[model samples]
Target chain A: AQSVAQPEDQVNVAEGNPLTVKCTYSVSGNPYLFWYVQYPNRGLQFLLKYITGDNLVKGSYGFEAEFNKSQTSFHLKKPSALVSDSALYFCAVISDTGRRALTFGSGTRLQVQP
Target chain B: EADIYQTPRYLVIGTGKKITLECSQTMGHDKMYWYQQDPGMELHLIHYSYGVNSTEKGDLSSESTVSRIRTEHFPLTLESARPSHTSQYLCASSEPMGNEQFFGPGTRLTVL
Candidate 1:
């Protein structure tokens, strides 16, 4: 079974500082990785995804992720953090051979302090 | 924002009451999914459909039932609302074999 792991329960960062939300995955074959953000009382919004090619994938709202195949990690990163960037972030994965539905990791709460 | 939409963004109902949470999309997506989420938690898929007249249960076991009678509409029904069913229900749609899905504003259901 394909699964994603977000080790951090919460990450605190100062506004304007670079932020990183760590994610790792386990799958039978090559993996497709994704990141999503959820604000209070709202549905999840897609941030980015890595399907194939390009180890560095950029996403909406000045966010990006680096897919490291050797480390089995796809960490979300931002050049600088904004207070509004504070939200719950989730990492999801789906293997090329397994079930089509994505398996999500426990979300990480990002708190960007001013 | 995605063209998908969910009705009754907030719903409160008594236990044993029958409720149908409506979901519709204007994007004409062939694949639609329903997910249940608790506050500050990862979403769990409850139901999904590839197209009209095709519905399948997801990884999680859910008592709620869903129907896909039209390409644009996929509604989930709870035969008996229970306290355990109180959670946010999200609807999503994507094109055939599309990797990313577009989500609708979730419906928060509180069963008392």
Candidate 2:
């Protein structure tokens, strides 16, 4: 079964500091990993995905995620934290063998202190 | 950009009321999905549609039902609303061969 895990329920970071939100996955074959962000009272917005390519994938709003196959992780990162970047983030995964629907992890709430 | 829209952004209704949440996309995507979410939580897929007149239930069992009568529209209907049904319902559409799914603003439903 393909599954994603975001261990932290919340992550707090000071403004201008680098931020990292941890994510790990379990799947049989090569995994399709994705990150999404959700603001208050808004639907989820896609951040990025790692289908097959470079280990590090850049995404919208100056965010990036690194896919570490050996560690079975795909951690989301930002060079500098911004107050507006605070939101709920989710990690999802799907494998070649399973159904098309993505399995998501319990989300992580990011609070960027101003 | 996304060209997807969901109607009744916020809805409050009494229990046992029959309600329909509307979703439409002009992106001409062939695959559409419906997910239920709680505030600041993970999303659970409740239903999905492959195309016009095609619908399938998702992993999470839902009392609600959906229809895809047209290529551009997919609406979910709950026969009898209950407090447990209260949640944010999201609609997403993806291109035929695209993995990235674009989401709509979502409908926040509350059952009283």
lDDT of 2 by residue, A73-111 (tens): 999999999999999999988886655678899999999
**Separate clash counts for every candidate:** 0, 0
User: In order, what DockQ does each candidate have?
Assistant: 0.69, 0.65
For this target, which candidate reaches the highest TM-score against the unseen true structure?
Answer: 1
The segments of candidate 2 whose C-alpha lies over 4 angstroms from its true place after superposition are: none
A21-107: candidate 1 lDDT, tens digit per residue:
999999998898999999999998999999999999999999999999999999999999999999999999888885657788999
Interface RMSD of every predicted model, in angstroms = 1.4, 1.8
lDDT of each: 0.93, 0.92
In candidate 1, which residue pairs get closer than 3 Å at backbone N, Cα or C atoms, i.e. clash? none
